[model samples]
Target: MPLYKEIVCNENAKLYLWKITEEIEFFKHAVLLKDVSQKRVDAMKSESHQKGFLAVRMLLQHVGYTDFDLYYDAFGKPHLSDGKCISISHSHTFSAIAISDQPIGLDVEQVKEKVLKIASRFMDVSHLENLSDAEKMKKATVIWGIKESIFKIKNETGISFPKHIFEEEFNLESKKTIAQLQFNAKTENFNVVFDSVEEYIYVCAFEVDPNFLQ
Candidate 1:
């Protein structure tokens, strides 16, 4: 499949998502991977993972970027050669990338009942109260995305989802929320935007700045 979804996040940021429907060989011939990325793809044990990896390159191409324009830091965080902040994520059949002038994080997670089973390990259980079983599962998945997205941006040592990141209570109907990362004796706020995409939750986090949400 081509671009599955695109969101103009702001004047300086955009998000792209791709649905993985092509065969491994199709993508292998469509995308040109660097030597290290080729080795990484070759080392993947699952065909699904390899497809997801290549699908991301397809998204990069959609935005007039090629694999050569991207690079990863020592912490595995992605960067653009032209000095743009970028975040990448993939889950199941979907792959996504977000580019911004400011620091950002993006995460895509398939909504599954399994997330509820381990909710307490990463989130405040009290926030799950007064909700139906279905809502519980959906909300839990969003919270998981919240933590994962924040971690992707910070990418710092000693950041624990359960111990350091906290989500402020918000109704799912709102389709938006706020969170905080309290780590290393510092606290930073983030503005969160999220929505469901065909049984999957897509979450994007932006650091609270003077121009944020303006």
Candidate 2:
């Protein structure tokens, strides 16, 4: 199978994208299979999940981790034995993973019109205003990705939408944005970067620290 492009961010995070060209057998060997159910196992036959698993495994190996033991926390967030923070996402035919020394989040979405229907659920007035006519559809998906990343970092579920968690708008020319998470009455902000590939967009956000993996 051919691997898609891999990007290393300035904050010591590694992102890997994999193009789905192999059969389902590739997923059977994934490190994430420990607690997965037969139904989830059957679901991996879908190309998107397979590619996502491949990307995640690649990042796990790159970070000097082997032995695929993934378990969900009380809130349903995936956790690893090592303290390394990790996140995984998948779009139609592409999957991506992000790993860093600090907690991190990553998301991948296929550009689709359905994202527009639920924009209000996750976006605020200012975020909506910043989007242009051509970008309106994509804006919600991006927001969803940002929120997913935040949830992974926090390892908490049931967080509210953009009103509770805010992301600063940046021009498309600028590939990065800042987001703030307010939960349990405390707030913390972090930087997030995004990139556009063939038919999908990928996003990654994490805490800022100098000691990220080089």
lDDT of each: 0.91, 0.69
Clashing residue pairs in candidate 2 are: none
Model 1's TM-score against the true structure: 0.96
lDDT of 1 by residue, 27-104 (tens): 999999889899999999999999999999999999999898999999899999999999999999999999999999
Best-matching candidate per lDDT: 1
- lDDT for 115 in candidate 2 is 77
Model 2 alpha-carbon miss at residue 211, Å: 14
Superposition error at 49 for model 1 (Å): 0.5
lDDT tens digits, residue span 52-92, model 2: 56556655565566436444577766666776666777776
